[model samples]
Target chain A: MKIIYTSFIGFVFLIVCSSIIISDLKGPESLILGSWDEVSWEYERVNSTENSNLPLDNLVKKEICSNMFIHEAETWVFKKNNRLQLVKRGHEEEELIYNLRGRGNILEMIHKDNGTEIYQIQDLTKNKLVLHFNFDLQVKGIVKMTFSKVD
Target chain B: MLRKFNNYRTHQDNLKIAILTACSAGMVNVLSVILFFAFTSNVTGHYAILAQEVAKGNWYQAAIVFIWISLFLIGNFTSNMLIIHSKPGKSTYLAHATPLILEIICLLTVSIYLQRFYLNTLWETEFLVALMLFAMGLQNGLTASITNFSIKTTHLTGLTTDLGLLFSMFTKKKYRKDKKLRRKAQILLSVVTAYMFGGISAGILHIKVGYAAFYIVCVLLGIILFYDYSVLKIKRRKRSLFTRKNILFSKKTL
Candidate 1:
């Protein structure tokens, strides 16, 4: 009985491990390679502004930013070879090269003028992608961009 | 080891399970984060993310987080269902072992997929995350059920809450002196320490060996499963041998 039990366990472990080993190898595919369209944008203040003392002032600023910049329709093309293109309505297309760092969650976009912007990938999927980055606009805040797969 | 299952389990047995399972949970959870950038063993963070996504009106992201939480729920349901519906006869060991075996299979499958066909796609990451959540659900459910909800290893929220409550209660001299409370405190501390150690070790090991960290978890679970079986088999052999000797002695006397 002892031998049988031990052998059974050994057999199962061997089978499971070997099955993994014998499985076909798949080539590494980048998760970010695709055409994406901007679906939504969210902005939140992380730190209070030193100058804006009134609560209503911050709210007005947020409202203005939301109305002015939140719903612009834009498309982004991310190629497999680390090329990125931003397309906006009635605007010149901006071309950039991107490098994915740290488990491919941190995206660093290199601009033509020797500038770089880093965005944290909050979420990524076949049909959806969410990117977040922090910046200062009289107050330190985060901007989140949500994208839907266009192609 | 097998006797603990048939009889009332002692504090030591509970502590052993608590420490070992907590270590396994920590290692698996941290390793998943390192590899997939996703949390698999616990649903608390997923719930928070779901709420945040919903608040932001990101319906697609919300749905994905919702699905991850559901997978965890399903895993727990599956584990408890197996435990509750298992026939109450000689096959009890099989019932108890079933969940662990299932967990092993899940971990093994994830490890195999990562080793063989990891494409770093969204679908692949979601699938692996779901698989891990289910595995953890099985482990959490089994440990909780066997120990009467006193040993939860997968998530630290409840454990930390309990620790806080225990610390508050220990302020009273009577509660501090209570042997049961003391034992519970010791068990909780040991589990927490083991979990932290496991997480730290997994962090270092994952950096050194990558996905092989998962294989180590598999081996740890395999030991638990086979150790129980081996002990049972030894006890059964001893009983049979003793029974045969008694029969021979009776025949000679007659």
Candidate 2:
């Protein structure tokens, strides 16, 4: 009887505490809204065999960066209705569906007819968003992308 | 390998299952992470995601995660049910083998489906992840139930906690001298090593052969199934030979 009573109390306590904390928290769906400018892209962890100090800006002109969908985009717009627009300076705009998984740490971008891509959300704040994803190419490494929210 | 249950099992038996199943669990977990961008062996992260989805009002995603969690649960339930309800004597081994057979079927289906019909869609990935989770649940359930909860291969959270506790207890000489405690530490260490080996091997295999690596896990589980039957066969043969020799000696003496 004592054990059952304590268990019940513990369960109720957990429920109340969780509800309180959840009410104050904001979901990533709301946090990721509006336009964000691409701040930079760099190798988070380059393959040991690859040149560690290679400049990504020069590499951006190479096939490695060209193959990535986001490489050409200057601005990312996350709109309502689960749509994400990749806007480039001169190229045509591309739209994709967006979803969050893994406690909102996994950013899933589903491209139309191109399948889905996932990025680990390294950091997310009101002003900035940092994403980490595997960059598979001639010289493969983990890529870290930073985006500053546009006012 | 699968016949013994609970108190009837020895440390060697538990160790064998732990190493084999932990390796497969590690492989399945890593494969799911690399291929589907999700986890299969452990549902801890998935539970958090489900909660987040619900809070965000993403009903569709929440439903999908719910299904994945439910399938894992069902897999465990099915395994335990088969074990506890198994008939006495002759059919015990078959009942234990049934869960692994079902697990093999699940993994084989995933492998074949991915190789042939996979369209690289989000829905397909989610479904594959769910199937993998179910298979892992079956494995974990069978190993745990049969070994009296001494072996759980799918995740390390609880194992780590127990190891920590045991380590603290081992600070005292009494616990160190205890045979059961020492054997447990050894089993835990071996399990950790085997799980790491499995994960590393799966990562390398995924790089080399892609999704075809799942077949290796099935092959390993098949060995576990075949081991006990072979041992039984050899033991029976030895018994028969011994009896024949005894009868020949008696006839000569007469």
Candidate 3:
């Protein structure tokens, strides 16, 4: 009886595991893959005394849209080839290729330059995208972007 | 009459254990896959694809997942039933080998089907999905064998409910015999924890590396196979030695 019971469990376990793998391989690709125009991104100073103080000079240097645009960027590419490369003018020639993967709609991208850099994309749509980043300095941030298709 | 009732009770116990182990095993593999590779247990999760499929009168994909799940259940049932009838040693060997056998069969079936339907546009690119289902079936089949029927790793519905009941028991009068219950709780907790870990790990790994999850499952299956084969070989050797001695004695007497 005990042996019977154990075999039964093994069968169930395999089924669930396989289903999960199926989802990752076959489910709807997350909507974050489309192009996006920079709207807003927040960069927190790791050593700042006043956590809320936004460096005015840093904010003004970029093309800030109504106190928006966290980082200076005209366009960003969320590719299907496991690369999320940002096309920014000043940063490294290409934002260190962040390895991207997903199961269904949930997408996670890890910056290969530093494995500690994690980005999550959620609540994605044709017109809107939410980018959540967990940086290496233990600082967390969000970027809310709204897009208009450029024909 | 009492003996009959006791027999029924034992049967009930065995059934309960079987169900528990199967569920826990499923949960464990789901969680492990998610933990190790960002894979998801449910294809749609909260998505209404089933409803959409139903509305569109295209229930084939949804039915496929269901059928996959059913095969897994059937595999579990067969393994359990076999163990119930086999001699103790033979049962042990069957318990471990059945899942391996099922996986091979499933893979062959999927490959054959894909070959036949390769030209069909409406067939849908679901070969991967089929493989996933087969893998899940194998995983649960094996897990059911390893941890006994005390754990259910696939769906947490029963395990979570049982945990709630146990917690309520904590508030009631303490029984010295509750020690067994406590041990049961610990095992359930560990399996549940492993399951959650699997989910997180699969999620992260799938995010980082895609399709590698299948290789991981293959590795796990291989380990179990090696262990079972070794045991079977040892048992066969022991039996052969005993038979040889018996034959030698008969020849000496003749």
The per-residue C-alpha lDDT of model 3 at residue A41 equals 48
In terms of lDDT, the best-performing candidate is 2
Quote the true-contact fraction of every model.
0.00, 0.00, 0.04
If ranked by DockQ, best first, what sequence of candidates would result? 2, 3, 1
TM-score of chain A of 2: 0.77
- As for candidate 1, its clashing pairs are none
Docking class of 3: incorrect
lDDT of each: 0.74, 0.81, 0.47
- Give each model's clash number: 0, 0, 61
Q: How well is each residue in B1-254 modelled by candidate 3, as lDDT tens digits?
A: 00111233343333333333333334334433342222223333313544553464433334444444455556565555544555664445555466565654554453455445433211233444435454455555444544454444555667788888887787766742587677667666765665666555545555665435434444444555665467568878999999999999999999
List TM-score per model, in order.
Answer: 0.71, 0.70, 0.50
Off by over 4 Å in 3: A1-35, A40-70, A78-100, A104-119, A123-143, B1-96, B101-134, B141-150, B154-157, B167-175, B178-183, B189-223, B250-254
Chain B TM-score for each model?
Answer: 0.95, 0.95, 0.57
At residue B93, give the lDDT of candidate 3: 54
Chain A accuracy as TM-score for every candidate: 0.59, 0.77, 0.44
